[model samples]
Target: MNHSATAMAFRASARRTLTLEQQAIGELIAKLDSSFDSACQELLACRGRIIVTGMGKSGHIARKMAATLASTGSPAFYVHPGEASHGDLGMITGDDVVVALSNSGETQEITGLMPLFKRLGARLISLTGRPGSTLARYSDVHVDVGVSREACPHDLAPTSSTTAALAMGDALALALLESRGFSAEDFALSHPGGTLGKRLLLRVRDLMHGDERLPCVPAGSPLREALLEMTRQGMGFTCVVDERGALVGVYTDGDLRRTLDQRGDFSLLRVDDVMTRGGKTVAPDTLAAEAVRLMEDSRISALAVVEDGKPIGALHMHDLLRSGVI
Candidate 1:
């Protein structure tokens, strides 16, 4: 084929696939009826974790749905239908909710276990393209994740159908999350190792250098002494405090450089003579993300942790970076 023809063919094929999948998902919006509500209700009322099962390509979508549900406060896990047939059926219990996915709703490995699920008295929820299929007929609630056609040119691959199923699963999970009033804090607890967890769960106190490690000096302390403290602490800044140990000013390396350029004599200078007064400070309980924002806004690299206007701790950019709080 000619180069122009090949480029045209690629664009045409990609556009066609995307258009088909978009319409498939659009069709799902109309299917959001009482059945979807019933499924969500059943899942919410479930006393135990949701058990999602499917076969083949549908199984892959089911696994992703299970992970999304688990992370979004729905509490779910996936079990392969083939495994369930081979002694994994014992995992399903009376208190659990079973969500079975199949594009045709006739996956033998899954349909074969219907009787055992019925015997166990577990609630059955089915996600299928065919509402009249056997799996739907046996389900307590059937969420129709039907799609008109596959994105595949031959209309054979599980492309649009899987996307619809995944979207439906996400819809259900987010609905449950909202109904339960699941806050960001609750979400962070489940994902303590994720970036959102680092932002929401990590606090200034957790990364701050406490009193012993803080580089602080009295207001009357000599500039040389403050610089030595800054060097000892290696934080690039030293906090200046009053008689009550309250934060009054701050002297950073930048301020020292500026002072040197503006003045020739520094040997007799005191902390108050060069310190910048009323510097930005943060409370220990402030979010590390908020601290980062403050530092970025002020164009500084460190902040003093204050309580009741008293300097109790201090921290630098490296501390936040080392703790994965940035």
Candidate 2:
């Protein structure tokens, strides 16, 4: 009844069930047979999408399988067996493949729909325990998802059977992936809203100071004039450009402090004499992530955005970090 005893009891119960489930899953993997390969071939050869259906626990597994297949380059979706029996069967097409899930291979709600699938000319792939059962008998490819035991202590629930079904679904998805030669870059496009896509798609041109905010002064400008430009632009630095507007050099607050540190001889320093030449700049098309890495490595706050070797704008880490993209 106390906290310690309750925790101990919970852990013991969890460990026992987990061990049984793992053993059952291990047996299923070792027994994967030719039917598995045939099922993969049937799905790969289909011109249309995969239609996955099941009831209850199998339905939950079917939904995950559908998502996995869809994201991994296979066109697939989950259709509830009960829903399909009513009016949802119209979603299936003759070029498609149907993957039906039922632990006993005799779930009436699931098996009942096989006749309609056949009538529509859709190939059937069954993930079930009993190969001789109605659903398996009708399937063009029957994957023996049978398990030796249930994780349920009473051997009544569908725990181990569902695990086998999910693993088989993953196998089918990955098999289709290898056959189609899917790649990570292709995957990133499908997940364009995530961080991976941002790293692959975002560019320097998309985020940089341009035109009026460049903090540029003419070559003959005095250090005092360049300092005023840096103050007005707040880019932590100023650029000195030739008449053609190509980058000549850069000067930051750091340069200003170091110059003033040596007895304030800044009066003799022209923008051309004091500026740091060949400062780091990036093409407008460079990825924002790559720019961040460059800035971090160089220990600098900003970089010039250039086009055809001419500085057009500036960008700082603050801008990238604030976008929640860094």
Candidate 3:
């Protein structure tokens, strides 16, 4: 066959798999009932973390599910079922709850450790295909993650089952999150390494150009002197300060443009005369993202960073854009 024919065949296969998976996901959504509530109850009752465990392909899904739970207000971690027999069982504590994943519901490693989970006072929630299996029989809560067939052509691989399990796990997490009134700040605390973390955790003080980098001139300073100060700092603006260095007004490129548009005499004006007095300013403790929000709201590109009425620094929208916060 030609390259285009092969590509078309591959696309056809992919489309079929995606359609099947979407249908399977809808089936899983319809299956949410009392069992899901009971499982959430057992988890919420736990005084400790949620311990997720599975074997092989299911283990990979379990690990990711655990991470999602941890980041979304539920503390969770993955423990390999095979490794549990090899002294890792110590990781599961009495106060914790175990979420075990197995498509067949009869995996040797998981079945062997089912009693241990209960014996340690840790309640077991089983996600499996066979509801009548021993693991499900002993489980305090059974969530049927049964999939008719996998996306794989062979129909034996764990594709559809893993996808269903992941979707179900997300459903459970988000439901619990809503019930518990979890907030974005809580989510950001868990995702400190990602872009969301930088936006939520970083403050105006954290990124502001301060001290030596501040562009400013005295309130009585000449317009030409303020222009020189703006040039020296390269902020395209200069703040006008009182005798005690308190922020009184600001002069910017836009202000200069407007001043020019008015056909005003620059030589006759002072920084205080041409500057915008009592301009909007932000506190040093404000969040950088909040600063960006304020700037966007006020339709301004640059702002004076002030603390206790004194201009301490300056910030530009370009700084936020470069930092991936905008």
Candidate 4:
């Protein structure tokens, strides 16, 4: 056959595989019943973490399912079924929920542990393509992730079945997450090193320049003095404070440019005269992400950190960038 025929055949095969997998997922969604609800309730009521176990390709899917459950609100971890018989069974307990995945539902390594799970009094939830098989027969609740056809042409590989199982796992996790009212803040607590965690967990106080590094001048100080302070601190702006050390205005490089464009002899101008009065300020407790939004919305690069209306610190866009808060 020509290259064109070969490429066309490959594309056709890919399309068929995707169609089969999509159908499998649709069927799984339709088949979701009280059994799925029982599984979710078991997981929610579990005082200990959910223990997910499987073998072969199902094991890989189980590990991912465990990770998804853990990253969301449900505490879960994966244990290889092959390892369960050799002391790993100690990980299971009465308070935990055990979810065993096996498309065939008769995998010896998995079915062999049913009695042990029962003896431990841990609730058993099975995900399988074979609802009538040994694992499902003994399980407290069985989620049928059955697929009518495999994406593989030979109907041998675990293609469509695995996809259905994974989708089912995701559905359960998100449902549980919403039911628990899990917020982005909760997610950030679990992912403190990721970008989303930085946005949700980092506060202005963590990145702001405190009193020691603050660039500011009394409202009565001359523009020249404020400029000098800005230069000294190298923060591109100077906060103007009142007699009580409360922020009254701000003088930034933009203010200087506007003053210069007016062609005035601003050297003698008071900091208050040249400054933008009643400038936007943020509390020290503000989220760094919130600060970034404020800066972007106001078209400014810096903000005066205030507490009880008193100037306490200062922060700039670069500070956020330096700390990876952006």
- The best candidate by TM-score is 1
Worst 10 residues of 3 by lDDT: 263-272
lDDT of 4 by residue, 1-326 (tens): 99999999999999999999999999987898999899888889999989999899999999999999999989999999889999999988899999999999999999999999999999999999988999999999999999998999999999999999899999999999999999999999999998899999999999999877999888799888999999999888988888888888899999999999984787778887779997889999999999999999999999999999888899989999987887
Candidate 3 per-residue lDDT, tens place, 165-217, comes to 98988988888788778898888888887789878888888888998999988
Every candidate's lDDT: 0.92, 0.86, 0.88, 0.92
State residue 164's C-alpha deviation in candidate 4, in Å.
Answer: 0.7
Which sections of candidate 4 miss by over 4 Å?
Answer: 1-11
Per-residue error (Å), model 2, residue 314? 2.4
Predicted structure 1, TM vs. truth: 0.97
Q: What's each prediction's TM-score?
A: 0.97, 0.86, 0.91, 0.95
Q: Worst ten-residue run, lDDT, model 2?
A: 260-269
State the lDDT of candidate 2 residue by residue for 1-326, as single tens digits.
99999999999989988887788778777878898889889988889999998899999999999999998898899999898878999999999999998888889998788888989999999998888998888899998888888888898988888888888889889988999898876777778888876777778888888889788888889899999999999988887788998888888887887788864767767878777886888889888988999999999999888787678999888888875567
The residue-by-residue lDDT of candidate 1 on 126-209, one tens digit each, is 999999999999999999999988999789999999999989988999999999999999999998998889989999999999
| Model 2 clashing residue pairs (backbone) | 209-313
After the best TM-score superposition of candidate 4, give how far the Cα of residue 227 lies from its true spot, in angstroms. Answer: 0.7
